[model samples]
Structure formats: C-alpha cells, structure tokens
Target: MSLASQVGAVATRTFREKLGPEILEVFDKSYKNFTDVQVLSGTHLLNNHDVVVESPTGSGKTLSFVLPLLRILQNSPEIQKNQEIGAIILSPSRELCNQIVSVIKPFGEKLNLSVETVTGGQKVEKNVKMFKNRGVNILVATPGRLFQIIQHEKTLISRCLKSVQLLIIDEADRFNEIQFEDHMREILSCIPKQRRTGLFSATQVKEDDDLVVFGLRNAKQVKCAQERNSAAPSTLKNYFTVCEAEEKTSILLEFIRQKTDKKFLLFFPACNSVRYFQKIFERCLTKRPLFAVHGKCSNSHRAAQIKGFSDSSNGVMISTDVMARGIDISDIDWVIQYDLPKHSSWFVHRAGRTARLNNCHMSRFLDKHEKVKLEEVKVPTHTSLKSEELRQKMIKIQVSDRAILEAGTRAFVSHIESYSKHDCHIICALDDLNICGLANAYALLRLPKMRELTNRKDLDQFERSSIETSEIKYLDPKLEKQRGEIMKEKHEKKVEVLAAKEKKRREKEQRKMKRFGGGRGGRGGNLKKNENLKRKRSEDEDDTENDIRLLKKIKRGKLSKKEIKNVL
Candidate 1:
C-alpha cells in the first residue's frame, strides 16, 4: 500500500482502539481543522520510527507531531514507570520552546505526564534541579543550554534522557546553521542511540540529510505539500521601493500611520536599527502602543514585551532577528522588512513569523538595492556544493572589501585574543590565520605570503616574529580600569539595595508576627531585633535623602547651614 493508504489504516486503528471515545470527542471539539498528510506522517512517527514531517506554518503541524507523540507515550509501559524524561524537543528560539511546551503540557497532563521548558534566558540551576527531581517527562530546550547541561551535569540530565524515547527537533533548518552545528552535534551525541529522532521544519534546507546522518540515520522523509510551489497559506505580498536612507524613516512612519486596524512587525538588520525605528515610531505614533524587542533587552524585559505583543493583536512589534524564530503570534496582518535580511534564510524565517498557521495577508517592504541583492541570490537548497568550487565561485563574485574587512576583522580579533596567553602563541597565530583563511582562502591566504613556510617549525618561527612585531593595540588599560570601577560601584550599590530591601521585608514580617499577638518569647521573639533593623534602615534613608537634597542645593549654588547640619 502507498504511504497515504497505510496512514489511513493507522488512523482508523488509532480511532477505534487507541484514542477511544473520550479522546476523539476532545480532539474533535478542540480541533477546528485537521490535515490528512500530517495525520499520516504523525502515525509513522508514533510507530517508533524516525520521520521528517515537513509542513507549512498553519497546516496543523504542531498538533501533528504533538498528538501522535503523546499517544505513543500514553501507550508505552515506560511512561507508567514515571520516567524523568520520556521525550525531548529542541527548538531554535526560547519562544518556540515555550510554545511547544504550552501545546504539550495539556495533552501530557491529560495522560498524567509532566512537561517542562528549558531555555537560556532562565536560570540553568533551576532547570537542572527540576530534571533531577523527576518533575518533567518532556523537556524542551535550546541547543546551547542543553549542551551545557549535558557537559556539566551529565549524570543529572542523562538519567532523564536514558528514559527518553522520543526526540523531536523543531525548526531543524534554523538549528542547523553553520555557527550552531557544533553545539547541535554535542547535543545529539548525548542522546542515547536507541531513542527515536524526528526532525520537523517549516522550510527544509539541503542540510536535512546531514542532520539525518549525524543522528537520525534511519529517518524517513515526509515532505508535506505545504512547502511546495507558491502555496504559502498566507497572502504575503512582497513589494519593493527605492528611497534614500534618510527618507526610509519618514516612509516607514507614513506607512505605519496609514494602517488603521491591523498590527505589524517591522524587522531591522541589527538591534541599533530596531532602536532607531522604535524612536521614530514612538515619536510618530503616540496614540498607538509601540513596543520593540531585541537581543539587547534584558531577558525579563524581552519576555514581557513578547508576551504583551502576542497577547494584543492591535499593537506593532518591532524587532531584530531575535524574534525571527519561535515567536508565535496570531493576527500579525503585516510584516515590514525595515532592513532587508543579510541572508535569504533569515529573510525566510522573518517572513515566517507572520502568515502563521494559515492566517493569510502579509505585506513585505524592501528597498531597490535589497531587491537586487535578494534577486541575485538563490534560496538555499538541500544540496551541498564542493568547498573549493564554492570558494572559487565566491571569489568570482564581487563583494565589497569593506564587508570582508568588517566581518573578518571581528573574527580575526577574537581568534587572536582567544590564545594570546598560551605558550604555543605561534601555533595559535597560525591557527587564527587558518581559521580566517577558511572564509576566503584563495583571496586571503595568498595575501599573507607566508604560505612557503609550511613546516611547523618555520611557520612557528615566522608567526612568532610576525605577531611579536604586530602594531595592534589590544586594549586601553585606563579605559578598562574605568569601566571596571564603574561596574564595581554599580554592583556594590545593587548589593546594598538588595540587602536593605531584604532587611525591610524581614522587619515587615516580624511586625506582622507581633501584630498577630505573638509577642516576645512567643512566635514573634525576633520583633525587637527587626525593630532595631527598621530603625537603622530609617536612619539610612534619612541620611540618603539629606545627601541628595544637599547635592541639589550645591548644584544650584545655594548650599546652606541646614544642609550642612543634615550632612553632619
């Protein structure tokens, strides 16, 4: 039988035997729409076989993986044993991890399974403790923190994973980036080979096969029709305009002001650009609630901003690529590319944020240069090209030296700084050059004519001489010291404030205890000590206020005897 027919048979069996009447009723009641393609793929995954489910944003892909996984867990005797972690899901963004956990929790809970989210923005220790205590059956996390946990507290996490049978990596394409591949490798290494792996992505890149090779060796490919052709569920209209950099802000403002009802997301290339647009938006649209979220914001602040934006459908959220993945907000009518993405992948991901889950109507704005650049590049395919051929092709293409310098200088500096103190400084230097050369070896390697000194000894000697006489100034000591002092003072003040707050809180608790008739020698015996602490706090506050007032007076050149008396 064909895959579809087999999937149909599985679904029929599942409905009759596995789901029963109650679950079917709940599923029917909660689900507005269901796709057969997802059902078939999900059934395949539930059978403990590796499967890749490639569906678009809204075709019920989340439920596709989730429901079958939950059903598998429900049927398994291992779940009854109270396994610490029955399944592991890895997503690219914290928001996505949280979203997956949110979806899994209700289903898992119904089956008496616990679900927990682990991401980088939160405390690692708390998550570690949660895993140790067997509080979670399904653990969803980003790659970085997950690797860190595996590296540092492997025993604690491994127990959970040894019990884990299902591992789903959502947004596989995003996670398989060149920068994060090593971390991804490290994470996959920790998982037991016996466990089943599933890779899910909205847009599958060519690297999916490599991902399969690394872990999911026997993985079955399930390419849903959602990603083929121009069948994107959303009516995402792409448009371009030519304008000077100075006029871009005015145009953006005018465009935002023109929109009356629908909410929008404006994307920028960097955090600085996000802030710049945010300021312009704030000034232009005072009546509307405008919020910006980026990597620069504190974790708590970013979470709050994202939550607020997600909750409200009428407000605009301006952000960088930080919100590109994992952000699930319904009713984002428009997505403006204020700054075009540097890479086609980023552009895809950013655009994916909107037109989510089949809710259509997205509009993208681009400049002429951005349009030209985007047109010149092809969307990344799931095929690898020869490295040398790729290098030659890149050399043939004209890229600005400024772009190369800007990118390479940063990497070069980091490489140099990473190994300056090692005794093998010459080797380190050579390695740095080699690392940098990998980007454009044909162009860069020949520039430094030390290629003839291929012998280790000669290379080392040449490197040492080259580095020793290098004119690069590492860092200004005075500026570094000033920064250190500023940070130290800020930390000291923060500690002092925290201590004061704690003292006040304790004093308040003691007062409550005394007020409830638990006096000295009773439950409130500590009241006197707390009262003394409160007295000291009041005195400190008074002194601080007086000092502030005196400073103001001094600033105004009106310092008087009363200020002096208070200071004394």
Candidate 2:
C-alpha cells in the first residue's frame, strides 16, 4: 500500500467531522505528518479493539492513542452519564501527566469533555474533591497519586469511572517499573474488566510485555520496524565525548558556550544533579534562563518549567529521569548528558529529546553523578542503618529549638555555624551557654538547617561539585533490589579507606594520652605528665652545664669547691 494511502487521511477526516473540527485541528497541530502509527492506532481503537503501541519518541504516540480515544469518547455520549469520567490516562511522572493534560485539554474543552489531572505532590484531599465534587470526564494521573485516590476513594473514582470505556497507560514500559506493580494491579482490579486498554511506550522489554499482557486482553500490537526501538532517529546526530569525572562539568560548560545559539534539554541521572548543575550555571553567570525539572520541585513548579522551557525560543532545561521518558518539547536543539545516563535505555530517551520534529538545535549545562543509587543495596550505610527516620528525627530535634528561636544568642551562634556537626543541639547549646558571651563550643553547631556547605572540606572542587555530594544516597527496597546487584568493589575500597582513617585517628589520640599522660587532645593526666617530663629534661641539661663550668673554674682556681659540688 502507498504510505499516504495507508495513513488514511479520510479515516482521520471522518473521525474529525463526527468528533468536531477541534479534533482535526489539534491533530494537525500535534503531529508533523499523519504517520503510520497514528493511522493504525486510530483505526484499531475505532474498531473497539484493544491496542499496544510501541513507537519511537515524537512519533505521535500520545495522539495516536489520544485521537482514537477522543473519537471513542465523542461517539459514546449515550454510554457516559453527565459528570461521569469517560476515559482515564495514567502516566508515570507529574510532568508527563501535565503534558498530557495540556495536549488534550483544549480538544477536551472544545468537545465539552471535562479533563482533570490527578498526580502526587498535590493535596490528596483536593484531588479527591476534584473527583467527587465536580465533573471530570477524563483523568490524567501518576501511579502513586492514582493508586492513593483509588485506595481511599475507590467508590468515588470507581463510580466516576463507571462510564470509563477506555484506559490508556502512556509509557507503559516505564510505568511498569514505577514501584507500584501491586498498586497497579489493584487499580486494574478496581476498573471495569472489559474497558478498551492502550499501552504505549518506546521501549518494552520482555518483563514489560509480560506485565502489559496482564492489563491487555489479546490486544493487537501496532509498532514501527523493530529497529526503531533501539535505533536513534535518522535526523539525530549522535556525538559523545568521554572525560574523567573531574572534567565533565568543564567540558559541559564549554559545550554550552560553544552552542550558545541553540536550545537544549540536559539530562542528569537524578534530581540532585539537576539542582547542583543549576548552581554551576549560576556560577558560570550565563545570561539565559536555566529551566529545571526534577522530583524535588513541586508539581506545579515542574509543570511550569516544562511549559516555559517548551515555549521559550532559547533556554536551557536541566532535568532528571523524569524528563527521560516520553516528554515532547519541540525545538530542542540539543540533548546533553552532563553525566552518564542510567543505562542504554536512558541514553536513547535522553538523546531522543533533540533531533525531533524534523530537527532544531538546543544547549544546556549540568554536572555531578555520585555513584548510582543501586550501590546502596549491597552495602549498608556507614552507620549501618537503613532508615533515615531516626537521622531525620535526630536532626529535627536538634534543630527544633534553634529552628524556633529568632533572637536568642544560641540561635545567633547556630546561625553562624549551621550546626550540622553537633551531635545534639541541646547539649551543644547548653555547653556553650555562657551569660557573659556566646560559648566557643557552639562552633560544632551549624545555625540554620538549610545552610549549604560553601566549600569542600573532604573533596576537591570537581568532586565536591557532584550532585551526590552527600556521603550517602537514598535507595528503595524491591524497586532497586530487583535491578540486580551493583559492582561494590569500588565503594568497598572507599569504605576501607575511611574506616582505616577513623581507626588510625583513634589510635593516635590514645597513644598521645598514654605517652604524656595527655596532650591537648588527651585527658588532663596526659597533659600534666607531659609538663613534668619537660621540667625534668630542663633540670638535667642545667646540671650538665653547671658541672662543665665548675670544671673550667677549678682549672682556673677561680670557683669555690662548695659551689661546684652544689652544681654537680
């Protein structure tokens, strides 16, 4: 069949007119050309058959399923009650959820289909209110938020979704890895068993296929040539420069300056890297806006950055794995990996952001990868503790009073220090309690909790600049454990060095206490003994000098025998 004929423009028009002109308008705006995926997915969903779509990034995957679902919802008015949600779209990240919402909201409004977003980092009570208090014909959500709402308000969401004829899981491959397999299954159980399901993603391994099969019932699969999964886009020019960890940031700065005219999507392994590099860019004193998106940013904040970056003509966005999935931002001139990507799949998705929609150029700056989080599984924390509740609680209690006190001397002292090294804020504060003046012991306490270390004590500039600047990292249990073991020899070597240093320090201090009875670092007994030894040594030296002088005086017969004997 001819490619255009296979694309079936007539099929698109028929759905458009019946659905309304809004559908056709959004379709053209959203996609570059009516690709085969759209044609095939559009036709398949129109046929009321389930579908599993595997297409490359920017291949109109969103619209492929979206357009078809729109057509379905448009024609299913009789089936959907007023205020009943007709379809549910589940994406993995808040950013992706909002992106989907942006894409379909206009079309949805034009068609009188109310669209609402349900994702984490927003108030659950508010989202629950959205479902129960008002009309939401379409719900776009992340797994955790979706699962939470359903778990708590199962009846309400289920009732709203009573007319939910379609369930679309965007980026099924990533969602499958979303640390919510059980929650996903529970969510599936809550939904109508026969709702037409569409699973869309760019990368689907065997495990993904297996999980997808659970939600889909003999769904027809529509995909590009198998090569598309692993292949970079033909238009994309892939280039990489491998440098030592220290040189990565400098090289990145140079690359961004060299490509100043282009826009970019720079990817980091984690959110901290994004924030850390934002600091780097600020230090470089760039004129352009530095857009950032990561798990740490509020949902609205992240969504705003994504939109603002997308609309801006020239800007840099540094993001984490959140953007590495299926986020379509047009006119991205370059996709820079400031750090090594998580894996092969990561390289593909991170690179896919650029060379999109017949191509454009972009620029960015980023840095710092600590060892990947996976290393935490095999090795316990240096403290041999897994949970941070105590650490955080301990931190909280220590800072509680100081965090509250505004004008107190202790607070002033803590502010000067930011007191992170203090074991207990209470003890540090009390020990330093001097009515006369601020206690010198307060030096151990850092005043404000939020103060950042401006200089590196243990690491060099390059090493300290890393996002994983912390001595430790956060790791989840099954989600991370299942990924397989990490090569721990490097970390083991590091631990050994630290352990030896600690041991050596203790032994040296102990010996100081024993030898002199005590040195400045030792007990008072060691200090007193050291003083006595110095006095005795001086006396012996004086006696020897006196005896030599007395001998000289005797040779000259100029000294009394009693004085000489007294000197001896």
Candidate 3:
C-alpha cells in the first residue's frame, strides 16, 4: 500500500485502539488550530518526506509533527522481536530528550513497541547495554553523548541503529544557538539519508538557511496560526525590573516568599549563578523545599531533583537553560528569568517550560539592559564553519607567541596577552620570527590570522573595519587598576556586611537568651549564684549546730544551772 494509505490505516487503528472519542476530539480541535502553512506541511510529512516545522512556542507544533510521525511509525511493518533500532530522535538537551521520550513512550508502549532513551549526565554504559541486551526500537538521545557512544562503540551503535528508518531532531533551533550544529551534523552524517527525517522547532527565524542545507532542504515548512493580538498567550506575562547586582538575591527571596504555593522556576544564565542563587534561597527560605538543576550537577542528583519536583505538589526549581527544552512538569505556575536568555530562542524555551500542554503560566523577569539586549538578539542559524577554505584562511592568519613578543608588535603582544591563552594558537611556523610577526600583526588588525577562519569572508568592509579597531586595542593599565580597585572595594564591602551581619546575629542570640531566663541560675547568673549558695549553706549549717547546742544546754539547765553555765 502507498505510504499515505498506510498512515491513514494506522491512524484509524490508533484512534480505535488507543484514543477515545474525547481524545480524538481534542486532537481534531488541535489540528484545526494549525495554520494553513502547518496543515500543508503536515500533509507533506504524512506523505513521508523530510520537513522542518517552524513555529513559535505554545503553537501546538510538537503535536503537529509528533502525531504524524506516530501515525507513520504505527503503520510501518512490525520488526521481529529483539531487533535493531527503528527510529532515533535527537534533542539538544538531556531534559528535552527525556521529555520527548516521556511523551512518546506511553503511546509506543500502548502500541506494544519498545522505546528507550539515552541522554548525557547518566551512565552511558548502562543505556548502551540496555539497548543492546533488550531491544530498543525507538531511541531518544542527546547529540553529544549519542555521538560519543557511537564513536566509542561504533559496532554497537551501528548494529543497533543501522536499521533506523526514521530520525527526528527536536528543538532544532538550539542546534545553532548552543553551537551544537557540528555535532548534530556529524550525527546526521552517521545516519542514512534515506531514513525519514523531521526537524521541529518553536521560534525559527527566516535566516535559518543552514537548517535547510542540513536536512530541511527538501523538507516541508509549517507555521502556526497567528493570534488575535501579536502577543503570546495571555497566560504568559513579561515583566522587567532594574536592580543592583547585589539586590538580586533579595529580590528573588521576596518573589519566592510572595509566591509560596506556586510552582516556580528561576532561570539563571550560568551554572555559577544557579549555585549562588541556590545557596541564597537556602538561607532566605529555610522552610521551603527548593531544588536546583544544572549541567554541573551529577546525573543522580539532577535526576533525583527533577523527580522530586515532578512528584511534589509545590516546590521551586532554579536552573539554567539545561532544563529549558526537554523537561516537562505540570502546573509550573511561574518562570522567573533571574538572568536574561543569551538568545531569543532560549527565552522562548525557558518560558516554554511553563504553560506546557496549554496548562500553567509563564513570566519572564529581565533587567532594563537585558530588555534592550533582547530587542537586538536573534537566534543563530544551523550553519557549518567546517569548510576547507575557511580553515585555510584561519591557518594563514594564525599567530605565534615569539612574533607577538617582538618589540614593534607591542600592541599585538598586549592584545594576545589580554585574551585567553586558548584563543591564541601557533598556527604555522615554529621557528620563523617574521612569519609569526606578520601573523600577530594580522591578528592585531583583526584580519584573518593563521588559523582557519570560517565565515569571516562575508563581513562587509564597514564591519571588518569596526572589528579591526575594536579587537586590536592595547590593554589599558589604568582600566586594569580600576578593575582591581573595584574588586578590592567589593571584597571590603562584603567583609563589612558580613561583620555587621555577625553582630546582629550575636545580638539576636543575646535577646533570645534573656527571654528564656539566661544561664540556669535564675536572677543571680552562674558565678554569683554559685558563690552565694556556698556561703548560705555554710551559715545555715553553723546556725543549726548552735541551735542544737543551745537546746542541749536548756535541757541540762533543769538539772543544774551551774553545770549548764560550765557546759555553755
């Protein structure tokens, strides 16, 4: 039968066996919500050609492509038990891959198909063993670890994955944003082109031609229907605040306190920020259960934290964009952008964490600077910097240290010294001082240096001039001194703050002690009470002995006044 007929047949079977009439109604309503562009693209995907589904977040784009893929997979011929991998889905982040696996696994299991996930931050050997030992027909994995596993055990991956008939890339926009395009392309090269490929993303820009060349060349395009207002859903609210860096912790604590019952996620720009905020939150909200998820966290810790948050009724999750794409937790009431996203796509993904499945709400907090930055930020395109011409250009311009250290090359030398050592590399000659000097000069000029420079050829003259002027500046000692002064001032300020805080803590302890009847000595305190009790005890004992002796003398007086007097 033709692919379309087979898809229809499987879809009918799926509707009858798995989905109820209510679910079908929801699906139909959701399908009708798609724009004409999306409908046409869905038709193309159903017909079994590669396609790129580009739409904004919360446009039902995931279901648009997933349903079609599922229909096709369900209709395809059943593989023998314990066979090779059938379909491979690649996601940009582990959370995303796991989320995709979660979404599809239920349906695959209901259809009696084997589905498994392989993401980074976990034991790769275990996952590989699982895939090999038990059969994994549908494999969901992240790009980096997936490629690493394939490279490490090519035979294992090839044997299990060679038969993959379909490949899906979720969150295709991040491929370029996170600089994973090369890794993704390498994975794509490993898989056969004949396999059905699908790329899906929310917030895809028009300038994404690299995505086209990668796999979306012959693929269909899908756009979501525009809303009445050009705005995102009413559930998503964008808020901006301008505060000093030091006040961020205070603001975060206040926000968390105000939204106690709401399940919130705080997004930070880096792992360090995530950790810092975690400690701050711990100190600020000691009673509330807060969890942090980041790339720096171990797999077990991350998994446990995610699982705990997922299982709990109310908790706060502070994380980087690592939890942006692939994690799915229901009823995430708010998304707080403690730090603005580096890219617009990340902004969308971070917001997408909440308001998933048309539930919950999203709010982004940005500083004034971040808001301005967002206006100019654009999502990167999935393009390769791996061409030979670019490599040659980089190689020609690459510099050596000996040349940079030359007397005339002081500016170049200063620039090189200012930059990270990793950024400067010896491209060509080990011994030629003149070649090194020329390369260093070119580097200082911001011209193509000895390294293989890719894509710099496209820069306009004006842009190149700006780059040259902006990049070739000598390090200013005054500026360095000012920076050091600022750092020292910050340190001194922190010390003062800590000292004040410690004094306050001591005062509070003193107050508590006074209120609780200080030191177990009643009014007199420890040392005074001990001395007073010892003196009183000695006086009491002496008084008692005198009284007893007086009683004895009184008794003896009756016998003889003179004898009593003598005894006294």
List the candidates' TM-scores in order.
0.60, 0.59, 0.55
Candidates' lDDT values, in order? 0.58, 0.59, 0.54
Distance (Å) between predicted and true CA of 383, model 1? 44
lDDT of 1: 0.58
For the record, the alpha-carbon RMSD of candidate 1 to the native fold, in angstroms, is 21.9
Model 1, position 372: C-alpha lDDT score: 13
Ranking by TM-score: 1, 2, 3
What is the Cα-based lDDT of residue 441 in candidate 1?
25
lDDT of 1 by residue, 156-198 (tens): 6666677777888888777666767877777766678888777
Better of 1 and 2 by lDDT: 2
Please give the range of 10 consecutive residues that has the lowest summed lDDT in model 3.
356-365
Report lDDT (Cα) of residue 212, candidate 3.
Answer: 56
State in Å the error of residue 496, model 1.
Answer: 35
Better structure of 1 and 3 per TM-score: 1
**Superposing all C-alpha atoms, what RMSD in Å does each candidate have to the true structure?**
21.9, 19.9, 26.7
TM-score of predicted structure 3: 0.55
